[model samples]
Target: VNTHGNTDFRNLFSQLIQKPEEDLELDRAALYLAGEEYPEVDVLSHLAQLDAFAAQVSQRVTHETAPANLARAIADYLFGELGFDGNSGRYYSPENSFLNRVLETRTGIPITLSLLFLEVARRLGVRCSGVGLPGHFIVGLDDTGEYLDPFNAGAPLSMEDCRALVDRMSAGSLEWTDQFLEPYTKRDILFRILNNLKAVYMQGREYTKAVGVIQRMSIISPGLPSLYQEQAWCHAEQQEFRLAIGTLEAYLQEAGTPDDSKEVKDQIKGLWSTLSRLN
Candidate 1:
């Protein structure tokens, strides 16, 4: 496929990947990724919108000193007043993956909603982290260990609430583990968001956008071998044979002796034969 030159995305990825993994800002980096889908979006302007929202939330939080109370206040403001809620009908919609659209529509899937909650909490001096709880993402404060499912009108979630979500996501075949409560690192959060965006694109057969998403995912977290293979697949689907061949080669370097490596090796050989025929 013909490459879509995205200089702004290139610069954003370069700047983000260079930062120490721990210090990478999940909120801002994710905004940039959403900005990729909307070339004309002014990311800084949306940031200002977040700042303004947080400031308004800060006003209602004056008398609420406890963490849980503050969290409830913020949730009431966001979900109750602002009308933010999960988009249950269209789970895989690309618009659900874009922050700008989420702001306008006040609807999104778990991760995007979680991201907005995380950012607002951080700005308001609330202690919170992103929980990549299996198939659904949630937010938790530092002190209370209390969870909030942002997708569900910022509803407070007990362990039972979490278990129910896990069961539903797994079709009642899986149970909750302690892993469900663990907070995701910033890099982890950003990577998952990109993965969500890529999945939506792939489902729509939008290979160009999927490739671009994986390209960003690869840069942000270079050690993920699966991303290289994904990039290769997208390139192959687009008939960018040479680029596909190169990406598959890169994936094999990271594959080692895994069972999947042999399959990838066969793919590379087939791609090479196709390349020769084209020549």
Candidate 2:
């Protein structure tokens, strides 16, 4: 994986998010985020590809056509004819999280595929929303209140099917609720994608990438104490004790008297001790 360091892409991403949530361009934002790992990503090319997809689908249906038929047309075009599907085998690979890679490979995890579906649907004049289930992401048609599982070849899902899916994904640990099917805002989807990337980086012990993801996450939802905590943890993993200590101190300053304050204080002390020995 080419993890080229580029502050330009990062700054572009910051500028992208500064837009009003309604005006934020999800596809462009995602492509920009992918630029962090793949500095050469062409945002306009991918957007054009999405436009082409919608243009193809538009040929099959008119604006006055039934939404169900429109949805079917979209599913058939993207999943059936185009062969876009979920990357189940290497589900955790960071490539699956990038829109540019997803557009190229035509296979991705639930979120990216759903994002593709949503973007295409949006282009085709369909108001589609992201339904973030506990362990999966699917697209919901805002017009008809219908759900489509993009990872599963754009399979239409019933409410009961969603319940069973939640149970299965969580191994019965998570209880079913209607709230799970609520549409996620544009910012929410981007934050979830970043969180997925962060998890992948942390699990692979790629602290630098993980830190970058965490910093972006903080930008999306700033002042979250947990983000600060995770950033400190990544710094510590990289043996950058002073940076970790400073992050934790910043967390302490922002999140005063939280339940985990004592634990964070102890962690700061431990890092300080390690730094003293190293010096």
Candidate 3:
């Protein structure tokens, strides 16, 4: 990343954490996070592109006033014309987690695609929320409670259909629950997406990349000790023993309680021993 991009990445997280939880611009924040992977990207330009797309969509729907109509227009515009859809072929690819790449390639996993759909819908003045379904993420309209599955060409699905879809995905074993349809807030969505990226990085033995993902997670929720602890583990995986120990110390200092501190102390002891052996 260039100096400007690096600054943007740091500022993005600072702004993300400083904002009141209710007022966070999660969509923009997510795009900024994704921009870190591509230093050449102009993050704000994509936000403008979203605004432009919304304007074009407005032209198409000027005659109609209903939100469902607007939803359909968005689905058609995003899925049909723009051709954004799920990347089923490489289901676990890390590129699927980056918004800039998703925008360029017009493909991503369900959560990222849903983010694009949600943000576009928002820019168009259509209300939307994220649905953190088990094993799949989708979008929901605010007033009507209607759901959109961006992974499936932005197909609209009723609650029962959603249940059925989950059942099929789980081979009929996982039971349906209303909690799955609950609206996921901005931080919740970011956490999930970052976790996805973390998994992909760890699976590829890209420990540094995994640490980067955790860093963003820490930015989103600075109080979360588990995230810092995980970052320490990632550093250890990358054989950065000092970084691992330092991160663990931060976790203990910031978030650990008396008993929890004891546990962390023992873990830190092991990390120090490991570091000694490495040296």
Order the candidates by TM-score, highest first: 2, 1, 3
What stretches of model 1 exceed 4 Å from their correct place?
1-5, 252-263
Q: Write the per-residue lDDT of candidate 2 for residues 80-133, one digit (tens) a residue.
A: 999999998999999999999999999999999999988888887788899899
> Residue 109's C-alpha lDDT in candidate 1?
91
Q: Which regions of candidate 3 fall more than 4 Å away from where they truly are?
A: 1-7, 256-259
- Write down the worst ten-residue block by lDDT for model 1: 1-10
- Relative to the unseen true structure, what is the C-alpha lDDT of residue 115 in candidate 2, on a scale of 0 to 100? 92
Query: In every candidate, how many clashes are there?
Result: 0, 0, 0
Model 2 — which ten-residue stretch has the worst lDDT? Answer: 1-10
Query: 73 in model 3: Cα distance from truth in Å?
Result: 1.0
Tens digit of per-residue lDDT, candidate 3, span 1-279:
112125667576667767886678876777777767776777778878878878878989876579988999999998999988899999899889888788889999999999888888888788899998888898999988889899999999999989988998888889888988989988889889999989998889988778878877777777687787788787787787788788878777776474578878888899899888878
Say which prediction, candidate 1 or candidate 2, comes out ahead on lDDT: 2
Please tell me which predicted candidate would have the highest TM-score against the true structure: 2
Tens-digit lDDT string for candidate 1 (45-158):
888988988988888867547878888878898899999999999888989887888888999999889889888888888899889887899998888978999999888898
